[model samples]
Target: MKRRPRRSVPATLTAVVLLAACAFVAVAAIQPIVGETPWVSYRSVADALHGARWTDLVPAIAGGVAALLGLVLLLTAILPGKLTVLPLLGELDSGASRRSYRSTLRAAVSTVDGVSAAKVKLKRRKVSVKVTTGRTSTGGLADAVRGALERRLDQIVPAVRPAVKVKVHAVRSAS
Candidate 1:
């Protein structure tokens, strides 16, 4: 089973804003009945809205903004989010987060001889490994790092194996 991401942040903010607006309207409507001053001057607001012409610049701008906001909310609700988990191979259903996957690959590359540090970047179709080593000559180091990375990938067995590309950076000696 594939796992899909969620638009929680946008949905949450939108819900909060709507709730606040509704609560404000409810309070404003109830204030006069209870003989209390409303937070907003409802009469002025009503007069301004009623008096404004449809073709007025302020009304037109407000209408455009509302339409744009509605469009954004609609699109967010309808669009499918990007996949957060990468599916793994095998009968049992399983997946790994991108962060963990990249770290695992980085660990594999770092374990190779002469590798001081490693950075792994995972993309849809490629895994880029950057290795930093103190060794002056980096001949054949890239290939070794790539091999270790591929070995780790084989062990994990992700459904879609991204191609591994290795780059070795030689750190200069302090002397």
Candidate 2:
């Protein structure tokens, strides 16, 4: 079976094309009146191009295109009802805070049986942990890591119930 090629239209390009098409249609529809007008009749398209009068239309055309693009982007942004930049801002502003929290959580979870090291990632409402275990069976190590992390979070942030996720990496034989 031949697979169909996926088609994608970039929002910016779509906005520009749509706006330019509308402008062209509008100009075409009014062409007869424009030709009849004294001002337009006096200045032909050749004269406009030669004298660089088309330069004057540049700003208006650019403005219309920008407005259309802005409208498309604004609608796309608002329709989703999610903050696009806030989480990025938080990551930038609170790097140290989050890193410290992660380290502390990692230390606590690493104390659990069979866990050799723990890596913690704390997002807005949840904590994810990757546990390096000293035991071949990762199931018990994952459970222990999750339990420790949840207990630590409950002690620190009582108002928030952090969802714990545990992944095991590099299981070793317990000596």
Candidate 3:
């Protein structure tokens, strides 16, 4: 089974910190509104726990939760997936034909001199490749994969641009 890439600890922590900051900002933004509402008030932590109506607290809590979720999504956009897999999205055709195309591309790329493994998916005219190369120069491997993919794509799907939407996953050897 293929394993997804592992996220760096600092990146994960940074995401958490950003989410917390977003939540803080959201809560701060909403605090004045909560204060204006008759149901909610700012009291000591002890008082808030004891007798504050659930209705009053719920909205603010919900807002905080929503903010946190939004921040999480924002962070997700910034961070790469943990696995060495690329998700192909957009107007590509579905069913076995696409899968076959992906598999064919993967096979072709894997046969290249330095590539150890390859996974491919197509979306619209774009092809996404996640390739692990045995070569030490990840950048060169990526370029080679792109070049090979373009050649194959010209023969298979001539309408697509070789450069426009090729998502390349370049893996480096651990020294």
User: Model-by-model lDDT, in order?
Assistant: 0.88, 0.64, 0.62
Could you estimate the TM-score for every candidate? 0.83, 0.44, 0.39
RMSD of each: 2.5, 14.7, 13.8
Task: Find the number of clashing residue pairs for candidate 3.
Answer: 5
The TM-score between candidate 3 and the true structure equals 0.39
lDDT over C-alpha atoms for residue 161 of model 1: 86
Per-model clash counts, in order, read 0, 0, 5
Per-residue lDDT of candidate 1, residues 144-163 (tens digit): 99889889999999998899
Q: Which of 1 and 2 is the better model by TM-score? A: 1
User: For residues 1-175, what per-residue lDDT tens digits would candidate 3 score against the true structure?
Assistant: 2234555665688778999989876776687777744323455545856766757967689889989977886776676553343333335642234456667678778777877777676654456777766556565666777778777766564333434233344465557
Stretches of candidate 3 exceeding 4 Å from the true structure: 1-96, 158-174
Task: State how far residue 39 of model 2 sits from its true place (Å).
Answer: 38
Error of 2 at 47 (Å): 14
Better of 1 and 3 by TM-score: 1
lDDT score for residue 25 of model 3: 62
TM-score of 1: 0.83
Clashing pairs in 3: 4-82, 4-83, 5-82, 5-83, 92-124
> In terms of lDDT, which candidate is stronger, 2 or 3?
2
- The residue-by-residue lDDT of candidate 2 on 1-175, one tens digit each, is 1122222345656778899999875775587676643423434765765766435877679779899978876676555331122222222332124455677788888788777777777665677888776666675667777778878776555233558888888666545
